[model samples]
Target: MTTNSKYNFKWEDLGDIRLGRPNLGTNTHVAVYRLMQYTMRDVLEKQLGPDKTNLFFIDAGFKAGVEFCKNILDCTLGFDDFGANLADKLLEFGIGVLRFEKADLEKMSFLLTVGEDLDCSGLPYSGVAFCDYDEGFIAGIMHQYTNLNFEVKEIDCWGTGDRTCRFAVELAKS
Candidate 1:
């Protein structure tokens, strides 16, 4: 990775799970993960404005999604296969439940939904939408799979009282 690279997510950053206690392999309660994420976000929001903090979270999530896709997912698979694999991986990793609400392959536009989203499925409503990170995550995954840039935005979030998080993804304009 270059010293000035925007995203320095090397695959090796994720170490072997087998070496991590041998009994507790990537298994943690959702509350624990949320605690860390929310706390970090809180600090960031306090230091930086909400917009900047959200950008940071999105960038982090984009990096994570790219690295995760490269390391864990098979990029060679077709749309259906890739989606199925992603669904299985999300379930296996206790991330969330992924569903496709709309897909237009020709236009490269999609509406994706995640039930029990890791970001804000159960958060108390604050009228403001959360899950900017998830926007970047979904974008990263789509970029990796299609080798095309995408713009992902959260349309509905649990923070806004939605049962599921909904994202609208479209190809980036040239």
Candidate 2:
């Protein structure tokens, strides 16, 4: 119900991976990441219920996205260039293959897709969209770039029997 007051996350919390893991390096198996994610989801769902668990993931992801944008992205670029940079960074980080399906710069609305998404690309069909965190992540990135709140919804996901994750992003109504 309340946030912890003693600690706030900073990008520095990631630490020096090269210095720390000189032998292992930066890369790890995707399954290992999913193991932590799914297990945490399971415990959180049991304790907080599915809705709240999703919210927690989204909120955490939003924080991460904001930090990521601030640290990794070049915010000075134009919209098109920003998108291209973001796509490149996502791929470089092994996050996903980001593609813009549609864009309406005047309306601040867009449709985007991430293929081979880190979260749920190979997941079995579960009849539910499993990318609430991704939704918040995109919104956070957009917010950081444009200084505007966005409403991001995952419309298709591997959990929903879709091959790629699709999202609709629009400026949030004030």
Candidate 3:
């Protein structure tokens, strides 16, 4: 909300939201966070429809992921170290636990699980996958880290009655 800058949004712009609430630093109830996300999603769906709303969310998450990688991750690490560091950082920030089921560097394909994800960890079954934003986030991080494009898709979600969110990641074909 400061002066319009020449550059895109940066992480520092998220200046400690707990500025005055030292007692509640970086700890908000999941219900409140879900309320904010779901309410905004409800409004976006009402105005833009489901498809467009999903796109908007994915776009937003993509930007966030790019910024997060630039600010928080070391992009120079090799494949194994990269994933391990990412997992550690995600856990440190309480984003989730990352478990790679498969990682084929030659094929640029990966299968992973996000346990207790912020997006849809405990949500009631909605019959559809609810991790489009997460897909974009994963793709963005991978793109920034590897300087390559990837297709990251969420195949299972808590919203789809899955205990953990499972995502399939593959290099995008040219």
Give me the candidate number with maximum lDDT. Answer: 2
Give per-residue lDDT, candidate 2, residue 67: 89
Compared with the true structure, what per-residue lDDT tens digits does model 1 show for residues 123-170?
A: 998887899888888888888888899999898998888899999999
Segments in model 2 whose C-alpha atoms lie over 4 Å from true places: 1-5
Q: List the residue pairs that clash in candidate 3.
A: none
TM-score of candidate 2 relative to the true fold: 0.96
lDDT of each: 0.87, 0.94, 0.89
TM-score of each: 0.92, 0.96, 0.92
> Considering TM-score, which of the candidate structures 2 and 3 is the better prediction for this target?
2
Worst 10 residues of 1 by lDDT: 1-10
Listed per candidate, the RMSD to the true structure in angstroms reads: 2.5, 2.5, 1.9
Cα deviation of 95 in candidate 3 (Å)? 1.1
**Candidate 2 lDDT, tens digit per residue, 1-174?**
226887888888889999999999999999998999899999999999999999998888888789889999999999999999999999999999999999999999999999999999999999999998899999899999999999899999999999999999999997
